[model samples]
Every structure is written in structure tokens, then in C-alpha cells.
Target chain A: MRVLSSNLRLFWQGTLLSYRALFHWLRPAQYVASKVFMPLAQMFFFVFLGTFATSASNAGFYIIGNAIQITAVSGIFGVTMSVGGERETGTLPYLFGTPANRLVTFFGRAFMHILDGMLGVVIAFAWGVILLGLDLSHTDLPALALTIAVTTVSTCGLGLLMGCLSLITVNVMFVNSFVYFLLLIFSGANVPIAELPNWMQAISYALPLTRGIAAARLLVGGAPLADVAPLLWTELGVGLIYGLIGYVLFSWFEFIAKRRGILEVF
Target chain B: MNVRVLFKYWRTILIVAEMTIRQQLMDGFIIFTVLFQPIIIALLALWMLKGKGPDYAIFVVVGSGLTGLWSSLLFISGNSINAERWSGTLEPLVAIPTPFEVIIFGKNLANVIQSLLSMVLGYIVAAFFFGYDLTIVQPWYFAVSLALSVFAFISFGLIIAPVFVMNPGVRAWQNAMEFPVYLLCGFLFPIALLPGWTTPISYLLPPYWAAVSLHGATTVGTAPNEIFFAWGMMVLFSLIDLLVASRLFKLMLYKARADATLGME
Candidate 1:
């Protein structure tokens, strides 16, 4: 019980400090611009392009897909930067020096981002309904919310892996932006999954957002939670796998850096 | 920058541009901006527009290329000054005998020239991979439009770089600015699809005119008068942009020196 309480305190502090130490430092104006305004602009561009490709009737498909995909702004970039930032800000040495539980520390970094990413998705959905004529008359509100949460967590899981890769790389933004844009293609955000070529489809399933997007589309089309539960479970499992891989990488990196006495970035 | 100054420092400008190109080619972010991002966007546009028929191949190629140009102009050229400051070179660059605007112009020139490669790559992707028999309907007119568009974009970029450096609040919106221009400028679609109020906004943007003339020249049956009007708008906007950028650079340099912020953020 003492150990459990101690770990909880470490988790909370890590979440808060890392969240605060984010590159932008959480200024409200920059936050809204990067998190709120930028994602909407991206969503609108694809929504319009999708409509132009097919027709206005298909706006919901693009809207829902993109609204869910917008979570990556926080999930990929935000979470990666938070984890990667530990190294960039010279905090990794202190972090590894502490006797704190690595599992709690590793997962704690993504805690706030999961919530932040969910809010981003909510805002995108709100914009969709307000401006783009997205009707939620038949959507199961709870199921849709769950979908948003799960999807965000799943994307943040991928971000964790990206964050680990970022620890070893200097071109983090390049990799982050590439994966973010590539998601717009492979995640069925703009183009339908069925329409993608066989190889693309294979990749689409392997990624996080693809299943979550399809599941959300189903619920929005009036399907029950039971119908999309498999996809949700699969999404959760995929996230767990990625998160576990990220944890392994983080632990291994710490061991190697300490062994080689290259723990601190020069 | 005065036209006379550009002519007088033509050799310096060329050297700066050559060095910038050599230096930035290794930068992953710049390489993505000038190359891969545009190609990926082109691929997405092609697959989305697959049902629209073969003629759209060239249109997607040019539109995605324009997206790259605007993105590079906004992000790369927009932050060019900040980049120098971050690297601790802005002060030396400013202290040099040569005019600061000339160096920035050459940098923007390098950026715009490198960006044109995205168009060529987009064209290749459409022709070879997508198997679209794409051809420019009016080669000579298209060439002229391309030249004017490059001038217009560089001039516009000149205004953007200093303005962003001078206004941190405005720079905060830089991420949100890219797609709206793409939407408003009709980079991927006709502005007629947007609401009526946005037409004037599109007309005010130099890239819209670039798109107008470039798209017009690429497709058949556009009136020569329409194309001429677009070219005229390009020349007009470029002149106005150069005028605005001249004052901006002067004021920026004055403020930076006065406040001792040139070496600061």
C-alpha cells in the first residue's frame, strides 16, 4: 500500500511537470492556435477536398474521419515532444537517476495528453456539427465519446513509440510531421479504406487510428456499442502493444546510455 | 529593396542563393517541405479525385505543387529570419556591408526555386505512376505564367518574413494560416465552390493570381484575356509587395538595432 501510494505521487508529479515543460510551455494563446485552430484548418481542408471529390453528401465521412484524426496534433506531436523533451531539456539524466518505478514514469508522460487529445477531438466534432452540417441525431453519444477516448489513447500509444524514437534522433519534427500527414492517408481520414490499394489497406489496419475511425463511423451511422466492440477491443490491444514496445525501448535506452556513460546529452 | 539594388548586387544574390541551397538540402524539414510533403499531398488528391476522370491529373499535379510552394513560403521563408537568429548569425548578417534585404531575397529565391521542384515531381508522379497523359495546353504561356508566379511568391514571401519576426502574436497563428490560404486561394479547387464573401479575399492573395494564370494556362479553352488579367495581377501584387517589404525590412532592422534585439529572439 505504501509503495502504491508512492508510485501514484510520482505519476502525478511526472504528468504535471512534463506537461508544463512542453515546448510551448502551455501558454493559452499558443495552445489554442496549435491545438484548436490548426487542427480545424486541417480538418476543413480535407473535408472540402473530399466533398469536391465526391459530393457534399459525403461530408460526414470526411468530417468524422478527420475529427478523430485531429487527436494526433496532441497525441503524436504533443506526447512525442513531452517525452522527447525530457532529453531535449536535459531532464532525462535526473529522471533515470531517480529510484522511481520506470513503468509508472513511462506511462505517466502520456496521461495529460490523452485527455488533451480527447478535447481536441471534441472540438473538431463540435466544429463539424456547427459549421459542416454533421448531424448526430442517430449517434449514440456515450459510444461516440468512448470512441473518442479510445482513439486518442490509441494514437497517444503510437506517440509513445515515436517519443522513444525521438530520444535517439535529432530530426524529430521531420518524423512527427511525416507520420501525422501519412495518417491522413492511411487512417481512412480523407480516402476510404476500401478504396485504398491492397498494400495500403494492410498498412491501414496495422496503424492505430484506422480501426477507431471505422468504429466511430459505424456508431455515427446508428450501430450499437456491441457491433463496434471488436474494433474497440482491437484498438485497445494495438495501443497496449505499442505502449509496451515504447516502454521496452525506454528501459533499454536507459540501460545502454548508463552502461556507456553517455546518459547526458552533450 | 530597390530594383536598382537587386541589379547592383546580382552577383552577391546568386552566391547567397547557391550557398543557401547547398546548406538547406541536408535539412530534413526543408527537404520535406520542398519535396516529399507535396508528393504525398499529390498522391492523396489523385486518389480522392480518381472518379473525376483523366483530365484532372494535370490539375492535381499543379494544385498540389502550389500547396508546396505556399507551405514552403509560409513556414520556410516565413521563419527564415528567426532561423538566422536562432543560429546566432543574424547579427553578423545584419552588420555586413551588403544590404540585409539582398541576402534575404537570395534566401527566398533559393526557397522558391527549390519549391518548383515539387511541381516537377508532382508532374512526374502523375505521368509515370498514375499513367495520366498530362500536357500543358499552352507551353509558352505556361512558361511565362510560371516565371511571373515565382516573382509574385518571392515578393509575397519578402513581406511575410519580416512581418512574422516583428509580430510574435501573428507568428503564433502561423500553423493555422496554411490551409486557409489553400482553401481561399483555390489551390486544390475553384473558389467558386466557397462562399461569395471569400472571393475578394482570394482575389487579394497573390497566390490566387498565380493559381489563376497557372491553372488557366494548363487547361484548354481559357480565354487569353483571362490569362492576361492574371499576369497583370501578378505584376501588380509583386510591385505592391516589394514596396511593403521595403518599409518592413527597414523598420525591422531599425527596431532590432535600437532595442538590441537582433541577437535576441
Candidate 2:
């Protein structure tokens, strides 16, 4: 009970710190530009293209897809770059030296970005709902919210995994871009997974957003939670696997860096 | 004296542009931007436009290609100053004898050239992979518009470079600006589809004019006068953007020198 309470406190405190840092450290223009307008613009770009390609209904498909896919960008790039950013700013050594449990510290620091990713999705969805006149009356709001939350968590896990990779990889830019565009392609954000070749489809299944996006489309069509339950379960398991593997990799790398005294080398 | 000085400055800008292009080519990230991202966008468009006629496919192909060009300009040319700062070279680069604007414009030149490669790659993908027949009724007009559009885009980059240099935090805005510009510019579709209010905004931006001229030159039944008007607008916007960029660059240099924050961040 005490341990759980301490972890909870850490989570809240970490979130508060990130929230403060986001606004205080970042200029208002930048925050609004990146966090707000960028996702909306991305959604608009694809939705319009989809609209041109087929019809308004297809545009709605892309609207929901791209809107939810914002989590992949915000959660992944934010966490990964923040990791590289800490190193560049010469603060990683101090961070790793702290006595707190690494896993808790990791999740704690990333908690708000997870929320921020969800915020991006919400904003995009709202834009779609308003601009595209997507009738959400048929949508199960609770189910959609739950699916979004899980998707955020799942993508955040992959982001954390990439963050761990950033610790050892000096080419964070390439890694981040590769991961980002890879997800953008494979996750059916802009194209249907069914259109992809068989091997690519297999690869897509292992990724975070495939099931989430699938479930999202269904949810948007007013499918019940029970129908989408299987997909949500698969997504949850993927997130857990990534989180666990990332934690292990981070611990191993941290141990090696500390032993070699090269924590700040890169 | 004025002509001689201007020639020397032009030489310096060219040198900087050459160096920037070489350096950027060596960057792994550029490969993704140049090759991977554009191809993915084209493929996505192809998939989306599969059942649609070849005309839509060609439009999206060119659109995605131009998206790559615009993205490179936004990230590369726009961030060239920020990149220098991060590398601790901004101060020394600024302290050099050449006017700072010359160096940035040179960098923008290199980025513009690099972005053109996307168009070529986009053409190849559209023609070979997708087997779409591209017909340009006026190749010479298209060539002129393409050349003018490059200058217009470089000028556009110049307008934003100062913002990145002045406030390092605004570097974050680069990503934000990209899609918005792409949407507003209507790189994939006609700007007519955008609501009544946005038309003026699209008209003001250079990319919109570029897109209009490019599309007009390629499509059949386009009026020669319309294409010329687009060319004229691009040139006008480029001139206005350069004027604005000149003033902003001067202010940025003055502030950075005064604050001793040229490369601190």
C-alpha cells in the first residue's frame, strides 16, 4: 500500500512538473503551433486528399484514422526527443543518479505526454466532428474514450522504448524519423491495411495503432465494446510487451553507462 | 563600388549554398525526407486514388512530391540557422564578413535545389510504378513556372528563418507550420475547395501560386494568361517575402549580438 501510494505521488508530481515545463520552457507560439495546430493541419491534409480520392465518407475514414494517429507522433517523438534533449542539455546524468525506481520515474515523467497525445487526438476528433460533420451520435463515447486511452498508453510504451534506444544511439534524428514515418505508413493512418501486401500486413499487426485504429473505425460506426474487445486486448498486450522490454533495455544500458562512466558521452 | 560589392556578396552566398547542400546530403535524416517520406506519401495517395482516374493519381503524385519539397524547405532551410546554433557555429558564422542574410539565402538556395530532387523522384514514381501518363501541354511554360516557384519558395523560407533564429523555441513551430502551409497552399487539391475566407490567405502564399502555375501548365485547356498571372503572383510574392526577410534578418542579427545569445541556446 505504501509503495503504491508513493508511486501514485510520483506520477502526479511528475505530471505537474511536465505540465509546468511544457508551458514555461516552451514559448506559447511554439506550443500552440506544434501541440494544437499541427495535428489539425495533418488531419485536414489527409481528409481532404481522401475526400478528393473517393468521397466524403472516405474522408471520414481518414479523419478518424489521422486524428487518432496523432498519439503516435506526440507520444513517440515527444518522449524520444525529450530523451535526446536531456542528454543534449547535460541533465541525463543527474536524472539517472536519482534514487527513485527507474520504472516509476520513467512512467512518471512520460505520464503527461501521454495525456498530451490524447489531447491531440481529442482536438483532431473534435475538428473532424465539427468540420466533417461526423455524426458521433451513433458513437459509443465511453468505448471510444477507453480505446483512445489504451492506444495512448500503448503508443507511449513504444515511445518509451524508443527513448531507451535514444540513450545509446547518437542518431536520434534518423531513428525518430524512421520510427515516425514507419508508423505513419504501417498503422493504416492514411491507407487501409487490407491494401498492403501480406508481409506488411503482418508487420502492421505487431505495431501499436493497427488494432486501435481498427477498433476506432468500428467504434465510429457505433460498434459495441464487446465487438472490439478482442482488438483492445491485443493492443494492451503489445503495449505491455513494449513497456517491459523497454524497461529492461533501459536498466541494462543504464548499468553499462554507469559502469563505464560514459553516461554523458553521447 | 556597389556592383562590385554585390558580386562579391553573391559569390559568398553561392559558396555557402554549395557547402550547405553537400553537408545536408551527408545527413541520414535528409535521405528519409528526400526518399522515404515522399514515396510513402505517394504510395498512400496511389492507394487512395486507385479507383479514381489517372488524372487524380497524377495530381496526388505531384502533390505528394511537392509536399516533400515544401517539407524539406520548412525543416531544412527554415532550421538552417537553428542547426548552426545547435552546432555552436552560429556565432562564428554571424561574425564573418558576409552579411548574414547572404549566408541564409545561400542556405535556402541549396535547400531549394535539394527539394527539386523530390519532384524528379515523384515523377518517376508516378510514371513508372503507377504507370500514369503525364501530359504537359506547355513544357517551356512549366519549366519557367518551376524555376520561378523555386525562388518563391526560397523567399518563403527566408521569411521563416529569422523566426527560428530569433527564438530557439519557435523551432518547434516548424512542424506546426508544415501541414498548415500544405493545406492552405492546397498542394494536393485546388484552393477553390477551401472556404471563402481562406482564398485570400492562399493567394498571398507563394506555394499557392506555384501550385496554380504548375497545375495550369500541366493540364490541358488552361489559359496562357492564367499561367502568366500565376507566374506574376509568384514573382511578386517572392519579392515581398525577400523584403520582409531582409528587415527581419537585420533585426535578428542586431538582437542576437546585443543579447550575446547567438549560439547560447
Candidate 3:
């Protein structure tokens, strides 16, 4: 009982610390510009150009498609950049040096990333609906939330992996660039995966972005809850597996860097 | 005259350019990432078109070429800005006898030349492997479009360089600009394919005009009047961006020098 209480305290502390750091770093003006306004601008750009040419239904799909695309891209950026930035700022080491349980620290950081992703998605989605007049009736709120949860975790995993791999200062920029284009190509953000070559489709299927995007498309297509089961399961499985892998690798890397005194290289 | 000083500094610019190119090529990871982008994009295009006709190859070739060029320019410019600022080397450049504008111009010229070369090479590879035809309607129009496009993009790069210098942390923001540009500019597909509301925003970007001009030049077999309009807009945008960038750079230098002295105190 005593140990359980201690563990709970550690988790709460880690969570609080992570949240504090995240909010501190996010410049409110830039956050609004990037996560909110830019998406609305993009929606406007696409809507004005293609509305007359395609069916209204198709236009709706395009809006939803771009919305999800913006969400996922912003989500990934939020996770990876935050992780890399925290590492660069020497806060990761400070957190590690604390008496908190490593697992709590790990999960706490991932939870904060998930929260950030949710905030970005919510802002972008709200902007799309209100400012761009995009229809949101196609969304199955519960199912959509589930899919977002899976994607957030999965992306957090990938971000953690990148944070583990990169040197401190350059990590966020390099990882963001590398992953941004890869996700754009595979996730069918601008185009459908069916339109890609067979080999490219195969690669897309292996990526978490593909599953998340597929699930998103179904939700936005007004499909019933059952229709998105396969995607949900795949995304969930991938998210869990990647999340575990990322946690282990990040913790191991942290340990190694600490022992080798390379943590100060930044 | 100060022409001798400019000439002397020009050698340093060349060395910087050469070193940048060598580093880009030798960095196996970055090379692989850069090379993979076009290949993946081409494959995606082939899948989408799916034996309908060979005309889609033209779209893939041009789109991938433009993408490669854009990526090269963005990567070099952003990385150069971030690297010089973080390494503290940019401070000394101000003390040199050469004018700052000349040095800035030299750097921009070097980056443009390197990016153009890489883009051409990538285009060749895509054409050879993917069966892309290299036909052109109006070579002069194409030439003009290319020149204007590079100038406009490099100007955009310059506009953001001060932000990068001030806060190397904002590299993510700089990098983030690529996707919006790629999507809205109609690189892989037509901007007409985007929804009606989004079309107007695409017009604000220089790449959209470049793409339209190129499409007109290649498909319509003449430089349309719109080409002149695009050229005019690009020149106007470049001038505005240069003015803002120059002012911001001056501010950055003043602050940086002040900080350096304070640190010594």
C-alpha cells in the first residue's frame, strides 16, 4: 500500500512537470498561427479551387481529408519536437535524476504528448468546422476519438524513437523533416493510397500513419462504427508495439548517455 | 575599389558552397532520405494513374523535379542559417571588409547553383528509371519560369533566415512550411483538384504561379500572357521579401554583437 502510494505520487509529479515544461515552451501566438489559422487557410485554398469541379460530397470528403491530414501532421510535429526540445534543454536528464519511477516518467511524458496531439487536433478540427464551413456529420465521435487516441500513441512512439536516435540540438528539426515527408507520402494526405504504386501501398500499410488515415477516412465517410474496426485494431496494435519499443529504447539510450557522460554534449 | 575585397571573399563563398555540397552528398543518411523522396513520389504517381495512359508520367517527372529542387533549396538555406547561427560563425562575417549584402548575395547564389544541379541530377535519374519523356513546348518560357521560380523561393528562404538566426528552435516552423507549399502549389496534382475555397490561398504562393506558367509553357506551346503576370508577381514578392530580410538581419547583428560583449563583461 505504501509503495503504491509512492508510485502514484511519482506519476503525478512526472505528469505535472511534463505539462509545465510543454506549456512553457509553446509560444501561444505561434501555436495559434500554426495549429489553428494555417489549417483554416489551407481549407479555404482547397475549397475555393475544387468546389465547382467536384461533387459537393467529394468536396466534403476533401475537407475532412485535409483536416485529418493537418491533425496528424501537427500531432506528429508536436510530439517529436517537444521530445527533442526537452532533451535539448537538459530537462530530460533532470527528470531522470529525480526519484520518480522510470516507468511513470516515461508514461507521463507520453501522456503529455498525447494531450498535446489532442489539443492540436481539436483546434484544427474546430477551425475547419467553424471557419471553413466543413461538415462534421460524417464523423462518429466515439470512434473518431478512439482512432485519435491510437494515432497519438503511435506517433508518440515514433517521436520517442527519433528523440532517442538524434543528437540534442538537431534532433527535432531533422526528425521533423524526415518524418513529415514520409508521412505525407504514405498517409494519403494529398492523394489516395490506392493511387500509389503497389510497392508504395505495401510500405504505407506497414506505417501507422496509413492505419490512422484509413480510419479517419472511414469516420469522415459516415461509415458505421463496425466499418472502422479493422483500422482501429491495426492502429491500436501498432501503437502499443511501437510505444513499448520506443519506451525501452529511449530509456536504454538515456542510461547509456548518462553512463558515458555524453549527456552533457549538448 | 572594394571590388578586390569582394573578389577575395568570393573564394570563401565558393569554399562554403563546395563544402556544403560535399557534406550533403557524403551524409549517407541525408542522401538516402533525399533520394528516397522522388522514388516514393514517382511510385505513388504510377499507382494513382494505373495503366490509364502514359501522360501521367509527365506529371510525375515535373512534380518530382520541382519537389527535389524545392527540397534542396529549403534544406540548404534552412540548414545553413541554423548551422551558422548555432556555431557562432555568423558573427565574424559582419567584421569582414566586404559588404554584408554582397556576402548574402554570394551565399544565395551558391545555394541556388547547388540546388539546381542536384535537382537536375535527380530529374535525370527519375526520367531514366521511370520512363519519363523530356519534351518541352517553349524552352524560353520554361527558362523564364525556372529563373523566376528559383528567385522567388530563394527570396522566401531569405525572409525566414533571420527568424532561424534569432531562434534556431524555429527550424520546425521553417520545415513545416514545405508541406503547405507542396500541397497548395499543385506539385503532384492540379490545384483545380483542391476544393473551391482553397484555391484562392494557393494563388498567394509563388510556386502556384510557377507551376501554372510551366504547365502553360509545356502543354500550350507558348508563353501565355499569364506567364508575364507570374513573372511580375514573383519580382514584386522577391523585392518585398529582400527588404524585410535585410532589415531583420541588421537587427539580428546588432543584438548578437551586444550579447557577445555583455558575455565578455
Candidate 4:
């Protein structure tokens, strides 16, 4: 019991410290500006020009698509880049030197990333509602929140895995670019998956973003939470599997790098 | 004095450009990702339109061609700037007597040549695989539109380069711009497929005009004088972006230099 209590305390402290570090790394002004401006700019551009391709009834659909996009951009890109940065800056070594459990440390940092992703989503949702004049009543709020949470956690897990595998800054950039293209192509971010080819649909179904977006659409189209239960369970299961795999792989890599004395190559 | 300096350094710039091109090509992964990926995407679109008329194939060809050009330009310029900045070489290069404009101009020139080559390769592959009949009735108008769009895109790239220099975390912003442009710019489908409000915003982007002009040139069988209008708009946008980017680059230089000096202490 005492050991468990101590571990919990350490985890809490690590999470707080991670947030502080991230806050320092990302200046407040820049964070606020990115959170506010990016979504607003996208809303304006999409709402203004998207009408030429589709219609107002589908504006709601576009808003939901943009939401998934915002999550991917903020969670996958933002969280993974910070992890890679920490590895590059030699902080991970000092972090590992501490007596904290590695899993706790990993989850703690991931918790902070989830928080950041949630904040970005809230800001984007607000921008979509207020600036773009999107109708939120069309969406089930609880399911939307649930979808965001699951998607963010799953994406952060993949990001953690990629960050562990990356050797250089260019590697991170390449991975991010590749993932962006893959997600956009497969996730039905711009068009319905039903409209896509069978092979593409298969790929989309395999991605967390696709499930999350599907659940989100159900919520946005005014379906009850019970209707989205399958989606929620699928996302939760996939997220846990990916998160566990990532945690194990990262721990193994850290062990190897430390044993080889090449941990500080960055 | 100017002529002498130009003559002295011009050969060095050409050599540097050549080396940059060689290094980029040697990276087979990058070549495949940047060049072949677009062709694959074009083929996918072609597959979707397997039973459509030649007009639809022509539309896909033009859209894919423009998309290929935009993506090539964006990835090369953004990634090159990012690589230089992250490698800590940009500061040293900027600290030298060479004007920053010249260095940036040289980089843009290299990127343009690389992107043009990639576009040509992509077009040929797309044509052979997809059975696209690319007719060039108003070659001059098409050329003019493409040149202007490339210029505007380079300027847009410069405007965003300072962000990579300042905060590497914001590189996603550079990419986030591409998604909307690709979907909304009437690239794979007509702009009319989008909602009513999206058309004007698409018009604002240079790629939309390039695609529109190219589509008209290839399909309408007669060159509309509107191609000149698109070129004029692109030039104006290019000039504005250039001015803004120049100012931002200067600011980035001063700030980065100060940060470096402080760290040295």
C-alpha cells in the first residue's frame, strides 16, 4: 500500500512537472495565438470557399471534419513533436535517472499532451460555433467529448511510439508528414468513407480517426449515446492496445539506448 | 562593384544549387514520396473515373497536374527551409556577407527547378498510366499561369519559413494550409462540389486560378482572356507575400542572432 501510494504521488508530480515544462517550452502568447487563429482562419476559409463545392446543409458535416482535422493537427503533431524535442534536449536521460517508474513517467507526460489536445479542441469547437456560426445543437455534446478524448489518447500513443523510434529531427518531420497524408487520405476527412473505394474504406476503418469521426458524426446527426456505444468501445479498446504497445516499445528502446551509451545522440 | 561581386559569387551559387539538387535526388525516399506519390494519387482518381468520358480524364489530368506542382513546391521549399534551420546552418549562412535575399532567392530557384522536374515526371507517368490526352492550345497562357502560381507559392513559403526558424513546433501550420488548398481549390473535383461560401476563398488562392486557367485551356478549346486576369492576380499576391516575408525574415535574423550570442556567453 505504501509503495502504491508513493508511486501515485510520483506520477502526479511528474504530470505536473511535464505540464510546467511544456508551458515553458510553448510560450503562452504563441499557444493562445495558435489556438485562436488557426481554427478561425480555417473556419473562414472553409466556410467561405467550401460552399462552392457543397452546401449549407453539409456545412455541419464540414465542421465535424474540421474538428477531426484539428484534433489530428494538435494532438498528433503537437504532442509527438514535444516528445521528440525532449529526447533531443537530453532531458529524457535526467528524467530516467530519477527513481520514478518508467510507465508512470510515460503516462504522466501523455496526460499533459491529452490536456493540451483537449484545450485545442475546445478552442476550435468554440471558434467553429461562434466565428463560423456553426450549429452545435446538431451534435450530441457528450459523444463529441467522448470521441475527442478517445481519439486524442490513441493519437498520442502512436505519437509516443514514433517519437521513441525517431533518431533525428528530420525523422520526426517525415513521420508527421506521412501520418498527415495517411490520415487525410483514409479518414474521410473531406468526403464520406462510403464514397471511397473498398480498399480505401478498409484502411479507413483500421484507423482510429475513422472510428472517432464516425462516432462524432452519429453524435452530430443527433443520435443517442447508446447508438455510439460500439464506436466508443472500439476506440477505447484500440487506444489501450496501442498505448500499451507504445509504452512497452518505448521502454525497451530506452533500455537499449541506455545500455549502449548512445542515449544522448540527439 | 555590383557586377564584379555577382561574377565572383554566381559560380558558387550555381555549385551550391547543383549539390542541393544532387543530395535531394540521392535521397530515394524523398524522391519517391514527393514525386511518385502524386502520380499514385492521380492514378487513384483515374481509377475512380474509369468509365467517364475523355473530358473527365482531362479534368483529372489538369487537376492532378496542378496539385502535383503545388505539393512539390510546398514540400521541397518548406522541408528545405526546415532542414537548414534545424541543422543550425541557417544562422551561419545568414551571418556571412551574402545578402539574405540572395540566399533565399537561390534556394527558391533550386526548389522551383526541382518541383518543375518532378511535375514533368509526374505528368508523364500520369499520362502513360491514366491515358490522359493533354492538349496545349494556349501554351503561352498556360505557361504564364503556372509561372505566376509558382512565384506566388514560393512567396507564400517564405512567409511561413520564419515560423520554422522561430518555433519548430509550428511546422504543422505550414502543412495545415495545404489540406484546404488541395480540397477547396477544385483540384480533383470542380469547385461547385463545395459549399457556396467556399468558392470565393478558393479564388483567393493562386492554385485555384492556375487550375481554372489550365482547365479552361485544356477543355474549352479556346483560350479565354481570363488567363491573363489570373496571372495578374497571382503577381499581385506574390508581391504582397514577398514584402511581408522579407520583413519577417529580417526580424527572424535579428532575433536568432541575439539568441545565439546570448547562448555563447
Among all candidates shown, the one with the greatest DockQ:
1
Q: Which candidate is the best by TM-score?
A: 1
Model 2 is docked with a DockQ of 0.63
True contacts kept of each: 0.70, 0.72, 0.06, 0.04
lDDT of 1 by residue, B145-200 (tens): 99999989999999999999999888888988988998999888888888899899
Per-model TM-score, in order, reads: 0.98, 0.90, 0.76, 0.75
- Itemize residue pairs with steric clashes in candidate 2: none
lDDT of each: 0.91, 0.81, 0.63, 0.65
Better of 1 and 4 by TM-score: 1
Better of 1 and 3 by TM-score: 1
Error of 2 at B26 (Å): 3.9
Clashes of each: 0, 0, 21, 21
Model 1 CA deviation exceeding 4 Å by range: A23-26, A264-266
What lDDT tens digits, residue by residue, belong to model 4 across residues B1-265?
1224335677665666677777777654456456655555555455444445555666666666666666655656666556665566766777688766456555655666565654566467556855567566677777776677666776666665565556655654554554467677877667776668988898777777777777766665544767767777777777777777778777877886767631221
Q: Go through the candidates in order and give the C-alpha RMSD of each one to the true structure.
A: 1.3, 2.9, 5.1, 5.4
Q: Which consecutive 10 residues in model 2 chain A have the weakest lDDT in total?
A: A18-27
Better of 2 and 4 by lDDT: 2
Superposition error at B187 for model 4 (Å)? 6.6
The reply for model 4, stretches above 4 Å from the true place, is A19-26, A33-36, A39-56, A131-133, A167-170, A264-266, B1-13, B23-100, B117-137, B151-223, B232-265
Q: Once model 1 is optimally superposed onto the true structure by TM-score, how far is the C-alpha of residue B26 displaced, in angstroms?
A: 1.6
Indicate whether candidate 2 or candidate 4 has the larger DockQ.
Answer: 2
lDDT of 4 by residue, A1-266 (tens): 98889888887887777556654644565555455455554544444334433555667666676676566665566656656666766687887677778887777666777867766677777877875667778777877887888877876766666655554444566676567556655766556788777988887776667777778777877888899888878876766776677678778877887898877774
